[model samples]
Target chain A: MSRALLRSVLELRPAVPRPIASPRILPATQIRALQTQTPRQFNPTAQFVDPQPRPSQLPEQSTSSLSSSSQREPPKQKPNPPRVRLPTTPPEITPQKLDPSVKSLLPLLAAQPAHYITIHIHGRPYLVTEGDAVRLPFLMPDVQPGDVLRLNRASTLGSRDFTLKGSPWVDERLFECRAVVTGTEQEPVRVMIKKKRRCRRKKHVFSQHRYTTLTISEVKVVTEVPEDA
Target chain B: MTIRGLPQISTGRNGVGAFILQCKRLDFHYCDWAGSSRGMNGFIKSLLPKFAAAHPQIEITVSPRPRKHPVVVGHYVNGKTKSIEVKNMEPMQVLQKVKLLRDASGEKDKRTTKPVTSINESVRGIWSPYHGNGMRV
Candidate 1:
């Protein structure tokens, strides 16, 4: 009894959802008996039973009662699952805001002249700045027709004049970023000529890649944050 | 029409002090420039005493600007940096200049001071407008 009590205490907390099932712990016979009785008041203990422990569903009290009640009534051999209140949807939490002092650092870092904005695109940081023409290691997609993105996130903001480096990331909230999207730029066509020594078989492949060009318009450090903001 | 930017003077006494320099920006109708020197003298003489009584600090000095848009200039302290932004100008011009100056000052704060958003709320229009875009006349 002490061991059973210890087990019950250890396994008492119900895990994710299905709360009604956790309360009812009767044998299959008792569960069917409860379901069949039309005039009986709803007692959750008369359903959901298993010899092995299934703590997520039924607590120990009803399981004990199931053994006692089964001797008196010869119940049907069917499992009656406890009532489950199906959740319409799960709860969602909004993103939390960073502390203000931390939030203000990003803009100051960006304001450095000739700043290199190292933006992590697909888990890889690409170092870039205004008027930077670049070729990507891989192609990016789902952009068309004058799509302008302000590449605000940066790991470093620096210039020939000065460089204020961030340990890892600069806060996006601290600065105003504006970048113009110049449509995809491409590498010059490459010609590969292949020749075989004996068979007189030759193969040639040509390839070229295009990359998006961006112009950093202005990175203004904001100090007078909007009051309502 | 009272001009500001009278230099702040150390009272030597600490808490209470008086400003050093005196300047005023006064706007009044200019009927004609063709008037004789004696006629202009009459106009200055007519206007001087009332203005003197109203604003004792200023001794009016007049000259016509090319476009006749009146402006006032003076000096003031900003953040940890000693810099000059147009202290006074046409309302629109002051607003524009203050914006550029605030940007510069914010940059200075980044270099020498704490990262909190520097706010000199006294400078109107130079301040970023709130999201709701509201003000009282």
Candidate 2:
């Protein structure tokens, strides 16, 4: 009877070991599951799991989330329209002669040290000297880095000694003005809380505008016949 | 609230605010003994001085071109020179030529087909075949 009692004690000891082993293994598995889930949420390369179904319907969902949120706003802000491609065709320009009296004075004007030009783009005037960096009011459509733009329409080209003014616009062939597109600049995001009277709902409107940046690469008076001539 | 100011510089329109004369100088060349320079010599002595005084901006020079016909050359700011033969012409005719040269822009004359020319983009954008409703056959 004592031998039977000893065997029963051994069996009871095995049951205790089993319960201890399970507790240790279970904690390790739970920790591993948590680690995997955390990475999935934070990893940029991980597959995107839609938290809400509405956003996934938009066309630009494949890219990063910043552009996706911009799309959800009102139609007034169209998804940054596809950049318009500038035509490769050259502008039609005709060389013009100055009145003899005006022509005679050009040498003295050109001899003056520095000059400034008032160039017009899209009917807006920008008075600048060479090497001036201008932040345009609107994003230039279809322009890219290193693209050279010839500014032909000008109101005036002047120096301290003399000013040459145009009736409406100075002949483009009279002056050689060029601008190089450096890149684009973005303004800081602005958040506006829109609240209606007698209503509890508050909508957050976010906007970030972008502008084209350009540098006045050159401004020179055309004293000689144009190369094309 | 949506409006934002864009920093831009005003562009210069050459003749919009002020006009600069393009003709910088005039040189009168005449032969003292040549019969062809008789009227030109008289004009230089009489009408030329008043014309020079009228246009202070223009630098005028009178020099003898030995044995050659009388000529007036206009120096333009465009690095071009226009010469007019005033041999045997009256002072009035020489004055007209001077006015013509002074008004010239120094560019070759071109036949303009369009009634009006502008740098502005067209208000109506170009039509694209890929866009808008497809034309029915």
Candidate 3:
């Protein structure tokens, strides 16, 4: 608040009081009073309580007049604690290595939301949406071509239009996205070996990447959601 | 087309069409801003375009996971992949890490290996979105 407005408010100066705007003055005064009482918790400056007329209403006379008027009308009380409408969380989905409790519920709660999970490969998070084509960074181990696979375990889940977000760990029970694995796509095998000549020690690192393609078929939310996404 | 120091959070159609690449049974190691150009962003930014170019029929978009969490926060692109993680490694080095994870969890079975337990009273805590403020997510 400017010093001029402070002086006017302290003096109870009624400036530009429109008929449609007079009622709002009461609530704004209440808010200001609350702010004065607890400046530490709340900001005492002008809040957007009334948007019609953006003028200060404090009188320019003396605070003594404002004090007498306040006395005439009994002091108003503030509202109690406000009810919060925060998002509710799914049950614990983390592994409690020491407690063992989190581990037990992990199977039941964490996987409840999704049947197929998009896994990240090569520093990339894959959609693995139903009917997705995935090429592994390297040849997969012991997997043949035309093999059916399901990718489960994802950090995120959402539809093209709608989305249900989980904190780093999205609630698993909220959704179920599944995919069918296709056959392997293999690159030519390559060899990279290291050896120490004097000791006759040769280490052979043979590499051949085989990736499995998946067809994601389903991605759906369990319950009805309001507009918020 | 590109994601920089900020997570490219989009529900745009291009990010979610058909064919999402997925890696299942993965133990998520990082969930910070997924597309922030610092580490993984540059890599994935390069990777997604190539895939889209090759498969012109399929539309592709990469966006952050719904709710932001440390354990799972990453990108969700089309029906293809859930995330791309560099972890401060080179492109090839990054590829090697993903390949290892894919090989380990190649089996189709995705059932959770964990057992069942109850929510104890002491553990009963609500997740407040804004530090125990108004929102809960």
Best by DockQ: 3
TM-score of each: 0.30, 0.38, 0.25
Each prediction's number of clashing residue pairs: 5, 41, 66
Q: Write down the worst ten-residue block by lDDT for model 2 chain B.
A: B114-123
Docking class of 2: incorrect
Which prediction has more favorable lDDT, 1 or 2? 2
lDDT of 1 by residue, B12-119 (tens): 310011221212233222223333233223333443344334344333345543423233232222223222332222222332222222222121221111111211
Residue pairs in collision within model 1: A22-A57, A113-A159, A115-A158, A130-A216, B3-B25
DockQ computed for model 2 against the true two-chain complex using alpha carbons: 0.01
Give the Cα lDDT of each candidate: 0.36, 0.58, 0.35
CAPRI docking class of candidate 3: incorrect
The residue-by-residue lDDT of candidate 2 on A3-122, one tens digit each, is: 543443332322221111111111111011111101212222122233322332222332222112222322232455333222133445566666665567767777876778888776
Task: Say which candidate scores most in lDDT.
Answer: 2
All candidates: CA RMSD (Å): 34.6, 39.5, 30.3
Better of 2 and 3 by DockQ: 3
| Model 3 C-alpha lDDT per residue in residues A9-68, reported as the tens digit of each score | 333323211111222111111011111111223222323333332122222222223222
